[model samples]
Target: MSPQQKALILPEKQGNFKVGSRSIPSPGIGQLLVKVHSAALNPVDYKIQDDGIFVTHYPAVLGVDIAGIVEELGEGVENFRKGDKVLAHGNPSIIDQGAFQQYSLTVATSTAKIPSSQSFDSAATVPQGLDTAIAGLYGKHLGAGIAPPWAKTASDLEPKYPIVILGGSSSVGSYTIQLARLSGFYPIITTASPNNEDLVKDYGATHFFDRHLSGRQLMAAISEVTDSPIRIVYDAISLPETQSVGWGLLAQNGILVLTLPPSVKEDEGKGRKAVSTIGSPHVPYDEEIFRSSWAMIEKWLSEGTIQPNNYEILPNGLEGIIGGLERMRMEQVSGTKLVAHPQETK
Candidate 1:
């Protein structure tokens, strides 16, 4: 029999998660077998368990943010070696590659070495949130089609533009604010609860407004800050209300990027557009851009160009994830990622 490992598994569509056993998978070409140290929870995890979206197989393992040590490397994987600490964006739909397991396989190109400045729990919070922000801001098909800061001639561009990110305290929103700053968007405006004002500003938001404000009120407040047109609006919390706010704030010919389906209707005459962003690098539309971005993640984290989100470690290892996900569904978690130490599971 192959070696076995502990995993949190969903037995069926919309099924409850439970501790289970699965065989440790081998590293295939361009892959690394990682011993998962920390796995971070996201809103999508509970959504998958509740709505059964984006996953088809039974007895599936679900998680996207992973940080761990490489146990072995597959053929053609040259950049990483045994025992290298790394962080990766896991594809939860694939059982062998999911983050909710003690061991899983990770795609080499999408994995980056975790810098000494970050712990496994902190690094685990970055993969999914950062990828979503990247796809929403820089992807041609999935986002606003803006030039990424990593592009060769991006630094030569001179025109400064304005951007608005709804839900600035969210993981995705925070990363979007930081990347927008790197892209040279001036007066980076964001909306969040007043308690998170300092947090979002630290992430590079040039202007902040209370998220509870009405769309008209938000627009009025933003007007007081910048005369430049709002060409891009990223609704990290794409609830119907937030979507409406983002759409209302967008300029003609501007794009409104949404993490969920857009609730606002687009008027053809106005030339405003709404785009739903997919954060997975496994998807073809975002694969290339993610590959390029992944190459720079290590340097970015090490240099403090990108800061990982605030995280709280969960108790009882894998079992604690259930309560954490419940808290997320109940809207109890705020401004922090919940990380579980899988290896600590009993």
Candidate 2:
């Protein structure tokens, strides 16, 4: 194996990305060295480059989703072999584990083997998206405190409530819609542009609202569909406008989960709360919660309970990611993940 690999690096805070050589890190205990075949882009990747957030180190390599072949294994890892196909939640905080490189390292706790039915490009879209859904729906403190459907404690819920997921076409939102269905949430309502209504419904959203609808219009429209009070709203978009719509729709004591910082303040003394999700499994608080979800990912993907986001591969390998991030920043990307093959890096 080569001692060095190509990587796209942010030379400094808020700096442009440049392709350069980086050392291929050795796997640590309970870790696997992966030769990344596919790396998916996220909105946060652009945000990091533009706003210089998340990474506290210099020359950062920012990427979270990963799917590839396990080139080697570290000590005490028994579930996988050296040549297994795997999908993992790469820890972007550590440059060596970032997925923008050809070879990356992933802890066994957050890695899962890809089923034969799935491709590396498709699997690349799952890690961050699915983990965000799990964090928003099942995190004891961060989420609505619902039992994970896959867990033994899962019940039909004391009330079998309905849920509203804003921006259902997004990667995170698509997975949220599916997980909502798995949790037995009836009348799974979501908001997306008209073009993506079918896409959201395919992911199990029972009802879809045009994203352009006013808060009042959406509230009245949803009321016509179901009388159930909206007890939970996952605002995957979390823009100020979308957050306001979600906050207005929530019944008292409901939770509003956001992927971004809350721009809309919650009303005081309404018993309604708004919280944000940190999707990385490497976070100390999220370790146990994320590990529990990661254990079921392979089965979920294999059985078709969880569908990957529709993805479009970018041209030019790792170099292609530069243009891809620009498109995402401009909001030109919709309804599909942008995937890049690091092996094609030049």
> TM-scores for all candidates?
0.98, 0.98
Q: Provide the global lDDT of candidate 2 against the true structure.
A: 0.91
Q: In lDDT terms, how accurate is model 1?
A: 0.93
Q: lDDT by residue for model 2 over 6-70, one digit each (tens)?
A: 99998899999999998999998999999999999999898888887888888888899999999
Please give the lDDT score at residue 17 for candidate 2: 92
CA displacement after TM-score superposition, residue 20 of candidate 1 (Å): 0.9
Q: Which tens-of-lDDT digit does each residue in 67-131 have in candidate 1?
A: 99999899999999898999999998899999999998999989999999999999999999999
